[model samples]
Target: MAQYSGFKQLLIYAVSMFIIALSFYQWDMSQRKQEERIHETQELRKQPLRETCAGDKETFKHRLEDVRNNELANLIVDDKHGIIYCYIPKVACTNWKRVMFSLTKDEPYPDPASISPDLVHLPNILPFLNSFPRSEIKAKLKHYTKFLYVRDPFVRLFSAYRNKFQEHNEYFYQRYGRHILRLYANQPDPPQSLKEANASGMRVSFQNFIQYLLDPLTERNEPFDPHWRQMQRLCLPCLIKYDFVGHQETLQQDASQLLKILMLQDNIQFPPSYENMTTPAFLLDWFSAVPLEDRRKLYELYEQDFRMFGYKRPRELLDG
Candidate 1:
């Protein structure tokens, strides 16, 4: 009886030890896999910027002109973290700015999403790199882990249109919609006056917007709105050595890597994207409304952006 009892005790002890060992092995593998994921994502984010600098030297030279101008104004500076972000409208600029606010200020918000979008853009809430003297701006640009996010040009254009035109955004419709209507509407002089235009509820069509964009004279009279402007022109990616370049396509992964690189993951999270806003189907539907010639012209207008960012011409916009 004593021998039987001893054998039973030994078996139980052996099984417990085996279970513990298995748990440790599983944990170690999990940790390693997570580390590998982070490393891969980091590499994916950095590859394009590396390729751009090496392969596109002449284009970089042309973009270098922006460095002479007060391009620092485009950047939102987080001096504490030694980070700088160039805010590009419609490319998650609001959330990026919101993250900046949380990073810079002590006022606690549980996460970036808790902050209102309107409040994020309020001047003086965040410090800008351009606010500093020219010499200081040069120093920060050289040392900071500067970054920016960009999206597909046509997709971004569509997002801007939907947000500004499709919705009941009176501000854009009044300011830009009327101007576009006056210029591109088939019926010449649709509204006799600005008040009449507003009262008539004149909205800029996607086609009208594209026509306005293709007109060289339009940009000469009034510069491109930052919303639809080329990211290359807006961010001056060539002039500045961005430590990380993120794409809006892989936003969650890229943003996760960014927070990890900055070591801020524990404190704040990037805002969730509006998936319904810029899907592949949404882009195809909108582009279908635009004629092929106009589509090609639109591509030509943003060709530098296409080549710089390594984005292929979206097949939806290509001639069949």
Candidate 2:
């Protein structure tokens, strides 16, 4: 009886161990399948961009002439990674700059998120491609993994407006807002209103902001701020064969794929995004404030951007 009882106990213990082993095997297989799917999706996202670069050598060279001054100055070079990123403002540029800083520093930071946005844009922190000789710049452009992120033109404009005008950005209010008021508010001494605006913490209205943008003199005197500048002009996508073209809309997935392509997944990850400003409701709320005539003009101004990036005009803006 004692022997029979011991056999039964041993059999039960053996069966439990076997079941546990089978469960682990299934989990491991599932994990492998999930990783494979992610890899496949990443490749699918990059396939078209890779194809776009295959036959465009002459066209890229022809478009390089238009890349003078600021456009050239904007490229942040990572020689170690052979990467050149054109930082377009209001398109998660601050975070991108932080990532670049991490990639190129003599001793890379383990956490890019810890770097302040202020520190990222310090003039000497990262070297610009333009700082290099023209020959060297050309070589990097040809062979480097060039990438830029673009947002919808109108959405980007709204973001700029919010960041610069709607928020308590003293520099922008003093520099651009004062000028905007002087030009559009029809007030010679708009300081009182400006003072009130500051004290009251009021946002610059979309209509008034539109007036500032549409004024021809604004561009004649100075180039549009990079925040609202057309992405085509800023990044010169036509001239540069970007190995990756990420969008602000699909930033996480696109950035993850980009990191995988660069083989930086183990070393660094794209910082967690804090804001998603491109939601349909958020867009509708802002566009509702913009008048029809102004909206049409804004669209006309950015028509090239729309075509270049293959973004359709938002139906809400048109219908509103």
Candidate 3:
């Protein structure tokens, strides 16, 4: 829920959000309407156009006010509805995908790995999403509701480094253009640009990126400073909060609310056992390999996230 002050403020905020959602949602609807109007106008343009079976009295009628009257005629982009599962590395993002896209044909739902060349940036997450030619995205905006699963940056980055890089083939690194896979426990500085990382084969997995941030001595043989201290010190919670800002700790509740808003309950089922995971909790691994100083840094970076979503960081536990 949005933070609001007076009744008037709440009303204004609610209206604004509604209007924003409506404006974008109505794009596909408006585009379809425009197309129909254009065709109708064209027919009128040729006032004395060719005579059909009955010339304007062809025994055909359309009820413009009702969708039931028009929808069956293929007048809507209903199936074109979509949801963006911008999968941030790790966190409990996997659980979200399972609840949202699992059990509906084809494995690996909400694959962030699916980030294609065309959909590289957020602006291009969907066609016509960059503001112009807004019809496609606009028309289907209502039909589509976007969903993103984010995690604490450090935790997420660490996991991404493991599963995406250490566990799998060096494909993502290749996507960013890193020739060599990477070594165990090796963390290097975050790359400046894809070009820079690709140029030096530093396009490692997100986890590897985490390692780089934690271990300053990475590839110590070379002078590796990525310029921006923030970039070099990027944390998971910070990365997630930068976007639409959802809660990983409250993932089920948040996701369920989203599903209810989108009216996708029938198609998607909120799982009773979302807690099921292939691996143990992250704190265990952090205590073993991650040093106290680095863990402290992670806690500090993600402290706000913990407080906002009501989660106790493992800092105290690790301390003792």
C-alpha local distance difference test of each model = 0.80, 0.78, 0.42
Residue range 1-320, candidate 1, lDDT tens digits = 99999999999999999999999999999978987887776566556656776787766643433465555557899888899999889888998998998887674545788889999888788888878877788788888998899888778888898888777676676678777887888655666554566577766789999998999997898778888988877887767877777888888888987887888888788999866456778677878888889989899898877766768877766764
lDDT of 2 by residue, 1-320 (tens): 99999999999999999999999999999978866876665456445434443445553324556567556877899999899999899888998999998887665455789888899978889989989887898898898988888888888888888888877677887778877776776656556455577675544577778888898888899988888887767877656777677888888887887887788887888898966746878878777877887888888888767755667777778766
Model 2 stretches with alpha carbons more than 4 Å out: 1-61, 106-108, 192-196, 200-203
TM-scores for candidates 1 onward, in order: 0.82, 0.79, 0.39
Each model's RMSD to truth, in Å? Answer: 3.8, 5.2, 23.0
Ranking by lDDT: 1, 2, 3
**What is the full ranking by TM-score, best candidate first?**
1, 2, 3
User: Which 10 successive residues of model 3 have the least lDDT summed?
Assistant: 69-78
User: What is the model-wide C-alpha lDDT for candidate 2?
Assistant: 0.78
Residues 192-223, candidate 3: write the lDDT tens digits: 44455555655454334544555546436443
- Clash pairs of candidate 1? none
User: How good is model 3 by TM-score?
Assistant: 0.39
Best by lDDT: 1
What pairs collide in candidate 2?
Answer: none
Better candidate number, 1 or 3, judged by TM-score:
1
